[model samples]
Structures are given as structure tokens and as C-alpha cells.
Target: MVDYKTWMKELDDNTKLTQLAIPGTHNSAACHTALPSVQCQGESVTEQLKHGVRFFDIRVGKQFLKEGDDAKDLQVIHGKFPVKIPFPRLLKDVLKEFYDFIKDNKSETVLVSIKQEGTDDWNNDKDEFGNCIWDRYVDKQKDLWYLKSDLPKLGDARGKLVLFRRFGVKDDEKKQKFGFDAASWKYNTTEDDRGRFVVQDFCEIQNKDDISKKVKYVKDLAEKAQKSNDDKLFVNFTSGSNFFDHDCWPQQVADAMDKGGVEKVFAKGCGIIVLDYIEAHNWKLAKALIDKNF
Candidate 1:
């Protein structure tokens, strides 16, 4: 297994070293732009750049990489959060390549948000009591289908081979825990607007129920779905654990699907669910789902 812990430590150390080497990069404060009108309250501009915040700003220049194209269409995705990519051009260069592809294709701006282990944004560690704070966050955003803009950087590029080989393909839990974070919410909460994420809550999914057969059931369904399909199957239940009704079987259906080889399974609806445990045992699964299609 790739030591993500080591990698981040190196990256963090190197980034500091690079800043010292550059003699002004760290000294320069990013100019604050206007707050998003979307009505969502997320980490303030300060919070966005907190530990583990990898934002990439990809400018797709005009001109199609294909047979014919026009340069006039070239324009910035303009007026939104930039993509998040790890710093230090050398190690993070693969992300640059991905950004270039997005620009070449003239797709809308693609914001790439990446989270490294051992960052404040993702609580990879457990307290004395143990809990999956990150998984709870993933579960919290299950109801919304984020306006995901796929970037080529996330695709299987040449560099990815080496990175994955050395690092091993990332597990699913990380993706799930942070999938919604990568996405920009369409501000569609009001009557006058279409579906544009207006709110951004960086909280975890607090499972309302306790550890029971439901967790096992969800696992079973995901396992089954994984075996049966070449294309990954993703499902999120709208119901949650009910305290009064032990028969609620909140995740019973999802569990059934997992037993059938489903590639991904998640819970939806409004209610608390345990996030700490999910992070501890299956953070990899959560990450896989997020990275695959958040």
C-alpha cells in the first residue's frame, strides 16, 4: 500500500520548503473575491484552503483538439471556486495535464477538488471513543445529485499508471467521504432559480441509528453489485434507522444489493447515521465512490 501518510507529510514538508525556496509564494495572500451568491455557507475563503484543500484552476483555451474547432468559445468557467490540485508542480504535474485536457476540449470549467490524508478537512483519525466523522459528512449530502463536472485530470491518464501502481488505486471510502465536497452545489433552493447549488454544508452524516444488521446489510448489497456488473452500480437509500421501529431495516435493501455485487451503496433521506465507524472500517469504499463519480 502507498503510504499516503508519508506522501502528505512529504508534500506538506516540500510545499513549505518550496515556499522558502521561492521567497514570496507563501508571503503573498490570495486576494479575496466576492462571496458566492448561492446562499450556501461553507468553509470561508480561509477554510477552503485549510489543510487537504486541493483546488485546481483550469483555463480551457479555445480551439478544439479534434478535427475542427473555434477559438472564440474559449473562455474561463469564470466566477466560481477554482479546481483543487496538490501543490509542488513536479509531483502534482499530472493534474496539470488533466487541466489542459479540459481546456482543450472546451468543456465548461472543471473544478477538481482533491483531499489528501491527514488533513483537517477529512478526519482520518479517530478519537478515544472512535468515530467516522468523515463518513457522516458523505451520508449527509446523499440526497443531492451534485452538478458534477468531470475533468480529464481524474481520467486514466498515462501518469496515473505509475501513480496508482506506486500508490495503489485509491480505496472507496475516501471518495465517498469527500465526493460532495468536490462538487459545486447548484443554487436551486428558491422558487426563482433553476438547479444551482446554493448551499454548501461541510458536515458529516450523523447516522441516527446504532450499529446493527443494517450496516451489514448495506455491505452485502454492495458486494453483490460489485460482482455482477462491469459498469459500477451505485445506490443510495432514502430511509434511515428508526429508533422506535427495530424492524425499520433501514439498510436492508441496500445490503441485498451489495450481496449481489453492487459496486457502491449509500444511504439517503434525512436522519443521523454513524459516520465515525464508516470512516474507520470502510473509508476506502467511500473514497472510491466519490472519486469515481462525485
Candidate 2:
């Protein structure tokens, strides 16, 4: 197997993106666990940063309000505030998996999905306003993942190295009309401490059916949650291909259906919502979760 540095260097050179340390701020607390770092060829590495796994340090550039301020009085917190920065934690976990997977095998090939692009539609103020009127409308992922790195360009396997985006939308007028972009964006600035952006609520669009329906569902849910004074909502979309679906996992049937369609359906509900982690060929039922939740 390639050394950790060699693997990282190969990724950097082939991917054309710089490695960055996950940043932090003064107000943010650190993880108690000393996450395992990557090591290869006598060189120890701190992260296994591929192109799709987005990383964000919630402590950098955080914002705060004085006590008793207009924004401070709102207290029915559910999805707002107490933002969840799952990237660093997820990164640590993925790296461990990567390390363990190739423990016995020398130079095992694995897939890495890095953030490629995202929309600049939501900023701090827009996020707050959207939260006021919408349920759990958090955009931290956009900044953390999308605005952080370049995703793998080709889905084809290279030297046992397999990587792809598990969640991505097609670039079409219909998809764009919903205000979700097909491209991922990387950040252009440095770090801060208090929290660059406070996340109210976040969800993945795991649902994989009808696009229009998903849009309507998400908007309606956001509206309903606002009326009920709810804090967060979860949304997700699914991409139906995996290693097995490809040459990596030949036994697996990797196919692409209307994943955007799936996300479109779940996007319609209100309140604190959670769509179960879905699997391939289950888009029909995943879409039905909208009916289950509604």
C-alpha cells in the first residue's frame, strides 16, 4: 500500500487542491477524543482529505450576541444554534476506516468523495431570516464542504482508487430552478473563533423520487415549521452508485435513478424531521417517507 504521505501527495497532485487544517476559535470546545491520524511511508498525517469529504472547524470566525439582545431572547431552540459540525468528526472516522481497510492489504484502492461546488445563495443574515421563516435552514455544509475542495472529476477507477459523490444533482434547468446548484464551492478566506456561521438546523435529502414534488415538499415543510415555531428539519438526496455497482464492487448493481426526484419529495415536510439512511433500489419507498412523515 502507498504510504500515507504518498497517498495524500498523489491525491493532492492528481486532484489539484491544497490540504488545509481544520480551524478553530476561542469559544468552540474541542473533541475529547484524540482522533487517529493517517500514516504511510514513515510519515504521519493528520487527515485523509479526499475531494468529496468536506471539513469545517465550527470555532473559526463565529458570531455572538450580547446578553438580552434582540437575537438573544429567542429561546425555543430546537434546530437553531448548538450547530452540529460533523465534518471533522466524520473525517476522523473515515480516515480510521481507510487506515483499517488497507491494514493487511498493501496499496488497497478506495473511493474518496470531496466537495466540488455549491451555491452562495445563503449568507449569515439570509440564513437567520430563512430560519425565522423556514424550518432548520442551515447552510454550513455549503461553506464547509462545497466551498472547500474540488471533487473527483471522473467516476472511473484508477489504480484501485475508487471515489464518487454519493449525493449530487444533475445540471439541468429543472434542478437549477429549485435553487440547488450542481457544482460545489470552496472557501476563499481564513478562519475565526466564535463561529463563522451559526447553524440552526441541517438535514440531508435522502429521498430519491420526483424533483418537483421534493421542492414543493421542502418549501411547504419550511413554511409549516415556521408557523409552529419549530427549529430544525432534515433533508437528503441519494446517489445510487457504489463500488459494487461499479467495477470496484462488481457484484453490486450501481444504477442512477431520479435521486433529485428522491430529494424533491422529502424536501416537502415540516417540523424536526429525519429520513432514515437509505440504500440503493429503495428510492420508491424512500420517496414514500414523505407520506410517512407527513
Candidate 3:
């Protein structure tokens, strides 16, 4: 087995990120929450990195303003609820952890899937949330990132923060593709041919019976990707929740999947398999997916 932290080093430089099977988390930073419905993962962002999770599905809530050049403090969120991590609420502080990880493990790359989260009625304008991310969080750490719209080879992307911008960008970049172009994805349910990505985020597990169907969806996509996986990115999510039922929360779903055998669900060319409670089943879930890359 390859070392979890530097697993990317084992892949050929000619390989595109889309071609590799990556371990990921649905809500990467919700490990600190006490709420049952919201807390998705058992590991922190940095800890997930050490466990061979390359793709991170991060949601940030825009907060109070600081007029100076300092990066805007963005709250880490899961739906309407706010989450607290070991670090401060500052997005910069959280991002600094990413930077530190990549700096130490230069052969690895972190795929950040960032989405704007919160219940604020206001929408994000060019100057506020978008500018805060592009100008402050991303631009400030320019050398540490890959802001291209298209997929990059493993060699070109090593030791970098590969951006998969889920939110919209500024005015000048409006016409062109920015980051991995995840701006338009099918919500809850997903299509098999979403151009840049093939996603299965069937998060509305209405009942216990739906969990198996969700697992089947993940398996079907994984099998499909293995057959004709080149070019398009496949994101299979093994996490779901129903707000009204405790039995259908993220933890329950994860438990069901583990009991149902998640190892068998993931196959070679599974793309990025996003899970909740990644540390479950003794980290075998993530290790199983990571083993597929070779």
C-alpha cells in the first residue's frame, strides 16, 4: 500500500486528475459540530489529507466585513447551520492549513470544491463573496493554486491547490471558464454526462429503502466510469440526509453503506468518491478507493 499522504507521487505525471480515483468528503470541515444532521465527517480537513482524501467539498458562509487588505472572514457551513473546526472561523486560517499540508507534501494536490453556503437572503455580488474568494483567499496565495478551467496533469498540479469553484466569479471572468467549471451541477440527483463531471449526489434519502438505491447509484456510476472514464470527472457521493428523520441522517447513511459493503461499491476509475464519516470501518472506505488508483 502507498503512503496515504503522498499517494499522488506514485501516479505518472502524464495522468490527468480526472483519470484518477480520488477519495473525497461531502462536507470536509463539519467534524466539529454537535448536531446530528450537520456533522458529516469524523476527520478534519488536514487529517483527511493524511488519509488520502484529495477532493474536498467545502461550503463557506460569508460574514462581517473588514475594509483592509486582510482576507474576509468566511464561516464554514453545512446548509443553514454554522460549524466550528479546531481552527478559527477565518477562511484564511483554514486555507493556511491546506497550504501547510501541500508545502510539506509537495507531491500531492488538494482539490477544493468550494460552494457559497448560508441562509442569508442576499445574493453574492462581484465585490462581496466572489471577490473575497478570488481576490483575497485565492489570489493572495497565488503561487499555491491552479486556477485553470481545464484539467491538469498530475505533474503540473503537484503541490498545488486545484480549484473547483462551485460559486460564480467576478465580471471579467464571467464569459470564460474558471477553475474546474463546477458552477452548474445537477442538485440532489445528477446526470451521467455532465460534461466536466458525472455526479451522483442523491442526498434526499427519504427512507431506509432509498439507501440501497443510493448505493446502487454509486456502484452504477463507478462501473460506468471504469468502462469509459477518461476526460469526464465522476463524483460519486455516499452521503445523504432527511431533515425530518434521524434514521436518514448522514451518520445513518454512512453506517448503512459500511454495513452494505462500500468496498464493493467503489471500483477502478470511480473518479472522486465523496463520503461521510470517512474514518468509518477503520478507514477501509477511503483506503479501498485509494487502492484503485494504481
Per-model TM-score on C-alpha atoms: 0.22, 0.21, 0.91
Give the winner by lDDT.
Answer: 3
Q: Name model 2 segments beyond 4 Å from true.
A: 1-90, 103-108, 116-276, 279-294
lDDT tens digits, residue span 163-249, model 2: 222224333332322221222222211111112111111212223332234334434543443343222221122111121112211
Best by TM-score: 3
The true-versus-predicted C-alpha distance at residue 213 of model 2, in Å, is: 4.5
lDDT of each structure?
A: 0.24, 0.24, 0.79
- Tens digit of lDDT per residue, candidate 1, span 183-211? 22222111111131112111122243322
Please identify model 1 stretches exceeding 4 Å from their true place.
Answer: 5-211, 235-294
For every candidate, C-alpha RMSD to the true structure in Å = 20.5, 19.1, 2.7
Could you give candidate 3's per-residue lDDT for residues 34-137 as a string of tens digits?
45588998878888888888989888875534333432467778887767643435566668879999999999988998888774533456436666677667
- Candidate 2 lDDT score at position 141: 23
Give the TM-score comparing model 3 with the true structure, all chains together. 0.91
